[model samples]
Target: MNVIETAIAGLLILEPTAYGDDRGFFLESWNRRRFADFGLDLEFVQDNHSRSAAGVLRGLHFQDPNPQGKLVRVVNGRAWDVAVDIRAGSATFGKWVGVELSATNKRMFWVPDGFAHGFLALEDDTDFLYKCTSYFEPANEHSLQWNDPILGIDWPLDGLEPQLSGRDRVGMPFAAIATVA
Candidate 1:
């Protein structure tokens, strides 16, 4: 596995070495020692999966009290994934990083706990999967507006309007999120 660092601290893009034969391919999705060697010492407690249509956009979401560090990937089809730094006094607060995750490329994105996460499906049906460092507690979850002008996320909508959930449509404005400068 090749782990690449992003401009934002704790965010990593990992590329696995896939061995393909006449039938299909095989790759190591997770390895405790290997990941630890690279200084990623996450203990995932839950795994989540979702399927979304092309225009569907989920999140810019995070759990405040119990923030979840996520290792995300696209099992089928494609998605444009994003992670935004929301740590109260971090150097990159309010900044973000985006990456295209696809089944073909088999890339994995690591979003650490201090950030909000979201994704846009680039294909008709996309299977999104992730390993979470913490168990989800709905009451602790919060959403940051996906289209917040302050963050200025350049979502590659490709002429289509993003289809958002009621919760996401009414997310907190970036400026309104209480954080110490």
Candidate 2:
């Protein structure tokens, strides 16, 4: 596996070395020792999967009390995955990085704790999967407005309109949230 660092601190992109033959392909998606050697020592406790249609946008969500470090990948389709730094004292606070995750590439993104995660489906039916370091706590969940002007995330609209959920559409702007350390 090849681990590449992104502009934001603590964020990483992993490319697996796939072995393929005429019938199918094989790749170790997650190996504790290998990941640890690569500097990611996350003890992922929960795995989650979701499917969305094209134009569907989910998130910019995080849990305040127990932030989740996520290892995300697309298994069936394509999406524009994004992660925003939200650590109070970090130099890259409010900055974001995005990457195109598709089944063909099989790339995985490591979003460490202290960041908000989201994705926009780019294909008819997209299946997204992720491993989280912490279990979800609804009472402590928060969402940042995906289109907040201050953060200025350059979403690839490309003449297409995004379909947002009620919760996502009503998310509060970052300035309104009382982020803790």
Candidate 3:
């Protein structure tokens, strides 16, 4: 797999090497030694999967007390995935990077701890999978407003309204959060 660093510190875009023949294709999605060689020494403890339809937006979510470092990929369909730096005292705080992930592209994203992770489905029945470094802690969960003016993320809305959960719709702005490294 090729690990590509993003503008934001600690974020990475991973492209797995695919070998195909008449039978089909083969690729090693995750290998501890290879990931360690790339400077990602995370020990994923949990795996989660979710499916959403086009226009569904879930994100800008993170846990404070037990932050999760995620390796995210799209198993089916397509999505516009994003990661935002929220770590206090970081040079790239409040900045974000986005990438298009799909079954065809077979791209993956690595979002380290101290960042908020989210994604927008670009196709119907999009299946998203992720490996997490920490187990989820609901009590420490927080959300940042997806369309906050200060952040100004250039979401490819394309005239469709995003479907958000109650918590996402009521997310707090960056200024309202008390971040501590």
Candidate 4:
């Protein structure tokens, strides 16, 4: 696997080597020992899978008291994934990084605890998966407005409008989250 570091600390892009034959391809998505070799000795407590239609957006979400470190990727179709640095007192606070994750690229994104994570489905029926280091606590979860002007995330929306959930539509602004984060 090739680990690519992002501008913000602790955020990474992992590309695993795939071996293929006439039938198909195989690649190890996660192996405890192998990940440890790269200084990622993490313990995941939960796994999640979500499917989104084109233009669907989820998150800019994170837990405060129980921040989760996530290893996320797209298993089918494509998505424009983003991670924002919301960790208080960090050098990159309010900064963000975005990447295109797709089944074809077979790349994984690592979003450490203390950051806000979100993605926009770029294709129909996008299957997004993630392994979380901490179990989710609904009450502790908060969503930073996906289109918050302060964060200024450049989502690849083109001519499409993002479909958001009620929670997301009413998310707190980045400035407001500063106090809580």
Backbone clash total, candidate 1: 0
TM-score, candidate number 1:
0.97
lDDT of 3 by residue, 75-100 (tens): 89999998888888889888899999
Candidate 4 residue-wise lDDT, 1-181, digit = tens? 9999998879999999999999999999999999999999999999999999999999899998989999999999999999999988899999999999999999999999989999999999999999999999999999989999999999999977899999999999999977754
Whole-model lDDT values for every prediction? 0.94, 0.91, 0.91, 0.95
Q: Which rank order by lDDT, best down to worst?
A: 4, 1, 3, 2
User: Which has the greatest TM-score?
Assistant: 4
How does candidate 4 fare on TM-score?
Answer: 0.98
* TM-score, every prediction: 0.97, 0.96, 0.96, 0.98
Q: After superposition, how far is residue 64 of candidate 3 from its true place, in Å?
A: 0.8
Q: List ranges where model 2 is wrong by over 4 Å.
A: 178-181
Q: What is the lDDT of residue 170 in candidate 1?
A: 98
Clashes of each: 0, 0, 0, 0
Indicate whether candidate 1 or candidate 2 has the larger TM-score: 1
Residue 27 in model 1: lDDT? 99
- What TM-score does prediction 3 earn? 0.96
By summed lDDT, the worst window of 10 consecutive residues in model 3 runs over 172-181
Cα RMSD of all models vs. native, in order, equals: 1.0, 1.3, 1.3, 0.8
Candidate topping lDDT: 4
Question: Could you tell me the lDDT of residue 82 within candidate 3?
Answer: 89
- Of the two candidates 2 and 4, the one with more favorable lDDT, higher being better, is 4
